[model samples]
Target chain A: MDLLEVKDLKTYFYTYEGTVKALEGVSFSVGNRKTMGLVGETGCGKSVTALSITRLIPDPPGKIIAGSVLFKKKDLLKVSDEEIRAIRGKDISMIFQEPKSALNPVYTIGDQIAENVLLHDEDLKNLSKKEKKREAWAKSIEALRVVGIAEPERIARSYPHELSGGMCQRSMIALAMVCNPSLLIADEPTTALDVTIQAQILELMKDLIKKFDSSVLLITHNLGVVAETCDDVAVMYAGKIIEKGNVREVFKEPLHPYTKGLMEAIPSVEKRKEALKSIPGSVPNLINPPSGCRFHPRCPYVKEICKEKEPELFDGRVACWLYGGAR
Target chain B: MKLRDYIARRLLLLIPTIIGVTLVTFLLTNLMPGNPVRLLLGERAASPETIAALEAQYGLDRPLYIRYFVYLRNLFMGDLGMAIHTPFPVSTEIMARLPATIELGVTALVLATIVGIAVGIISAVRSNRLSDHVSRVFALTGVSMPVFWLGLMLLLLFYYRLGWLPGMGRLSVSIGLEHITGLHTIDAILTGNLTAFVDAVKHLILPAFCLSWLEMAMIMRITRSSMLEVIRQDYIRTARSKGLRERVVIYRHALRNAMIPTITIVGLSVGALLGGAVLTETVFAWPGIGSFMVESISFKDIPVVLGITVVLAFANIFSNLIVDILYGVLDPRVRYG
Candidate 1:
């Protein structure tokens, strides 16, 4: 069975101007030990999609409009908020962007990891103060070890602000996976680290994921990261997924023009460029999106019908006019 | 060695700051049109011989800089000079009243922190809910109400209307407890006089509440705003995504980070509280250093006023030092020399 199956997920932000459809009817699925790479340009709703899975969307201005996020046997959208919370860190966990900001500065990285493990167990929560401390310490050390922190005992006692950005990110990944979560949602986890550190972290994550045998939802703007780490790819634009396929197939023969453009946009290592191949225009505004295919404005091949009626996710989940309802 | 060095550096700076504050209060107190001799010896204290004797005795006949030196020298020598209106030394009177003010300030501070932090966390987590709106309204209303007015209103409501509490003084003065600490509540508790202790607490309740109300509001608002901002941070999101409960997200991760701003506000409020105490003390008729400071100012009692100013400045400086030291504790990245 698939670890996660999201169907028509629609997250909206209710602003004064109008409701911004941040994630409009997005759908995907990942199997056990599979890594699904979600790629898009900035402001293309990739992060919003990740946030929607955890139901971490800030309210008042933001709301989940419609969708069904099914994990295992349960429909996550229909689950109680309390239940969703229980599932979030243990059933599925997330690694955030900007590792420096992703770990609470006031708390030690170990405490944060321990919090994830202790969250679901009432016994752990209800333990005597001393016992709670003992348990938290043990769990924290274990998590620190998992993240390749050699001095787990020392690091567990130290605050996140004392750690380097790379260490912090590793701690974050450890925190997410410590509960032995079945799935991990890593939202640009390596974006803030330098290129070398990024490669090392990704390698570590790959080794850990293989060792733990867990699924991953990898969201990034880096095509190279997707090519390196992910098994599958979903290219999104204007709050909608434009293309979905096996990572190698998609990278080798990108179906959507936007996907093709994204690949070309990646700066080749051979020569640093003065002007990289830029996607012609910015992401379309979600509040007042184009009538048809949302990416039509930026698409090199825009047809008349692409402007009026929105294209449906075709067979094999291709989202383009040229796909013509076919995979 | 580091902590010692830190404290030493702060103390070194504190010396000049205290002097500057003392000087300003001294100059202002001296400049104000008031006759200490007249206030001390009635209207007939203006004979030339009597005035000269008074001036010589009080060391007021000296030039401004000389008097200033005498002030500093006396302070260093453990003498805070004499009170013109009373037989007791300025230090003695302040010491007598210091316990009461400390009791009041500590109670009020505790009250402010508890109420402020709770309300702030609630308002931020449940932003835009009824509780959030109510907290916001309470914060604004609390800020606008003058301390004296609030004290009076509380006095009237709790004392006159309800007749549940004492109208003035630390207690009814009937129930006497051991005055080991000079603070009635502390002394009462120490002597195992629960009734007197309760009475003393009852007496403090209304005034402390009145005093703490603005501070509570400020704390709540700051905490709320800071928590709100921190909750939006990536760490909080990461916490939530960790499958941690909302309670953990709000309290453990968001609350502490939020305290960065709130601690700053707390330090400033401590200073402001000391400043605001004079008015509060007057309104409540509490015999604190604030009341003494006010009386000294009116009588143009330079020594007492200067003494109060130094104490207050020291209180502010020390409280801030504690807060700065706390920053290193709360956030490990803070490495102060």
Candidate 2:
């Protein structure tokens, strides 16, 4: 069984303006030790899907309105708060987009990491306060060392504001990976970093995934990152997943017109052009999205049926009338 | 080392701040109507020779600058001069009443901080809900209600009507504890007089609550807004995602970040309270520096007023210094500078 199987997840944001249908029946499965890249443009619900998996969506505004997030055959949506809390940072941990902001400004890197270690590590449950702290501190330093942070002791003692962006991101990765979670969710983990640091963080993440043998649900808009780091890819448009398959197969074949447009839009040294090809129009507002196929507005091969009815996953890979009739 | 240097700089700055306060207070008190000598002498004040002789004896006959310089010199020597109406020195009179005021102020501050932070967190967590609305209304009433009216209302309810607690003074006439600290509650505890201690506490409740009500409301409003801002931050989400219990996330992760503004308000309230909760003290008939200071002002007793002003200035500066130190402790970024 897959490590995480998100079945027909529907998330919505109840804003003052209107109800935003952020995620509409989004579904995907991340296999054991596999990295699944959820790729899309901004506001396409990539991050929302990641948050929904762990039930981390801010409740007042955003809610996982429907569907089951089955982790290891257990429905995460159905679990009690305490049960889910135990699972989080132990069974499934998440890394966020902005590393510096994501870290508590008042605490030292060591203190923050040690906090998680103490919270989730069951062996230290019965230990005395002093012993637990010592163990947690030791584990925190080790976690930082694993993330290639030099002078882990000194770095651990330093607060988030004292560190550089790359350092903060490294600390964030250390915090997430410290408990050896089975599923690691990285939501644009390298987006706020320098280009070189971005590459470094991705490499470190790839290495850590292999070392921990953990599955990753990597959410990003950068297709290059997916091509380099992910084995499986799920391309999302607006609030729906348009295509899903092995990275190599999807990149080579590019069945969905939107996917083809996204690939063409990528800047390449070999095929230089006066201008890059972009998909027509922007991502639709999910509140009042177009009927049937969400990509039909921008798709080159739009059919009469595409405007009338939504297409189901054909062969459980692509969702378009080109693949098959609307199910 | 850095912290030590920062504290030293702050202490050095206190000199100028205190001098400024003294200068303003000195000018204001000296300019007020009514001669202290006449007030002190009473009916005998009608005799000019006695008034002049008494004024000369106290060095009040000197020119303004000379008297100011003389006052400053004596202040440095810890001689706060003589109280106009009393035989004891101004310092002695102030010292006698200092503990009573501090005991009430400290109790009120503690009550405000605990209740304020707790309700603030509750309101922020359940924002816009029925409980949040209720707390908001409670805070609004606390802020808007007149302290004297509130104090009287409390006394009327708890003391006169319900007859459950004492209404005025620190303790009953019969209940006397050893004068260790001069604060009845502490002295009672020190002497192991449980009954006196209980009596002191009952006497304390109404006035302390009245004194703290405004401070509590101010702190709650600050904490609520700060917590609301902090609750939306990425770190809070990070803390939650780290599998920490919600209590730990809200209290440990969120509260610390939210406390900077709340601390500022608390520091200000402490200074205000310690400077003498005049209205609260007056309404409760509590024998604190507040009533004493008010009396000195009416009598135009310059020395006693100056002595109280110096204490007030110190209280404000000291609270501010404590607030700065707390900022460093709460945020490392502030410590380095």
Candidate 3:
């Protein structure tokens, strides 16, 4: 069985203009110790999908209308808030895009990591305050060590502002890994770092994932990052995933026109092209998205039927007219 | 950026600020039309010989620069000169009344800060809810109402109609509790006099509430907006994702960051409360520096007015410095260089 399975997740944001269908019937699964990359352009509901799994969408403005996020055979979406909270940092943890802003500025790195450690640690419930603190401190240092940080003790004591971008990202990874969660959601984790630091962070995450044997839902727009680290890829356009397959399979033969465009858009050193290929139009405004295929407006090989009827995900590959609705 | 060096630099900067304040106060008070000598002695008693003698005694006959230097020298020598309207040292009068003002000001500050922060947090947490709407309306009313008017209304309602509180003064005439701290409540506590303490508190309630109402509203509005801004920050989301309790996420993660600006407002409001105390004290008949200043201002008592202005300026500056230090404490990113 998969470690986590999300089926038909739908999330919307009710704004003054209209209801924005941020994630419309999004579905995916992560197997044990496997990494699945959700690649999409900006505002394609990748982040919203991650937030939905944790039930972290801010209400009144945003709400998850329908979804079933199953973790360890338990439907997380159906659980009470308290139950989901208990499962959050323990069973599933998430690291964010901007590491610098992700950590509380006022707290020392150690204190923040220790906060997570203490919160999920049941054994510390009965311990004295000082004892719990000491245990948390020790665990935080250990977690920091796992993320390849040097002098974990000192780094933990330093505030987030005192650390470099790469160091802060390392600390974020340490925070997420401290609980040895079964599943980890990384939302554009290295997007804010420099190229060198980005590579280092991705390398560190890869190492940590191997050591912890945790399934990962890696959300990013960088296909290179997906190819380097992810075992499987799910391509999202507008607010829906248009394609999914093994990383090599998707890269070698991308079926969806959106997926093909994304692959061609990457600036290749070998080709030395004068201009990198880019999709013709921008993503649709989610408030009033395209009626059928979200990528229909941008799709190069658009057919009449494509504009009127939405495609369904077929056997192991895509949701497009080219697939001929074959199972 | 070291904390010690930063504090020393801030302290050094205060020297020039204090001097500037004193110089401005001296010049402005001296430049005013009314003469302290003429005001001291009434129109009926004023004679050229008496006026000249009084001018010479007070050094008002000296050049403007010379008089300013003399004022500074006397100020440095711990002498605030004498009150023209009253036969008492200006410093002595201020000292006698300073505690009353401090007690009222501090009580109002503490009450407003605690209650304002609580209400503000609730409003921000449940933004647009009924509680938020209620607090916003309350804040609107508080900001619009004048301090003196509020004090009078409270006095009329509680003291006259309800008969639940005292009408005026720090203590009732019958409560002869010896002055320990010059703060009735503290003195009462020190002497183990519960009745005196109760009477002192009763007299304090209406005035302190009136003084703090505007400040409370300002604090609540600032805190609510600050919290609303901070609660949307990425760290707040990170905190929530950590599986922290909603209260922990709101208070520990969101509120701490929100407090930086609110602390600044609190410090500024203390200075505002001192200014408001002039009206609040008059309406409640509370004997404090504000009331003393009000009386001195009417009589055109330059020495007393200047003395009070200098003290208030120092209070404002020092409180601001304290708030800066608190900023460093609350947010490690704020380092003084």
What TM-score, over all chains together, does every model reach? Answer: 0.90, 0.93, 0.96
Go through the candidates in order and give each one's DockQ.
Answer: 0.71, 0.78, 0.84
Ranking by TM-score: 3, 2, 1
The TM-score that candidate 3 achieves is: 0.96
Clashing pairs in 1: A89-B242, A89-B243
**lDDT by residue for model 2 (B211-259), tens:** 9988899899999999999999999999999988889999999999999
Segments in model 2 whose C-alpha atoms lie over 4 Å from true places: A122-128, A269-273, A297-302, B1-9, B31-56, B60-69, B160-163
Candidate 1 per-residue C-alpha lDDT over B119-195 given as tens digits, one digit per residue, 9 for 90 to 100: 99999888999999998999999999999988888888889999988777788778877779888888887889999
Candidate 3's DockQ is 0.84
lDDT (10s digit) by residue, model 1, range A146-252 = 78888988888777767888888888887877777789899998988999999989998998899889999999999989999999999888898889989989988
Q: Give every collision pair in model 2.
A: none
Cα RMSD, model 2 = 2.7
Off by over 4 Å in 3: A122-127, B45-47, B160-163
Q: What is the lDDT of residue A70 in candidate 1?
A: 85
lDDT of 2 by residue, A237-322 (tens): 98899999999999999988889999999988887855777888989988899998988887889899999899988988999899
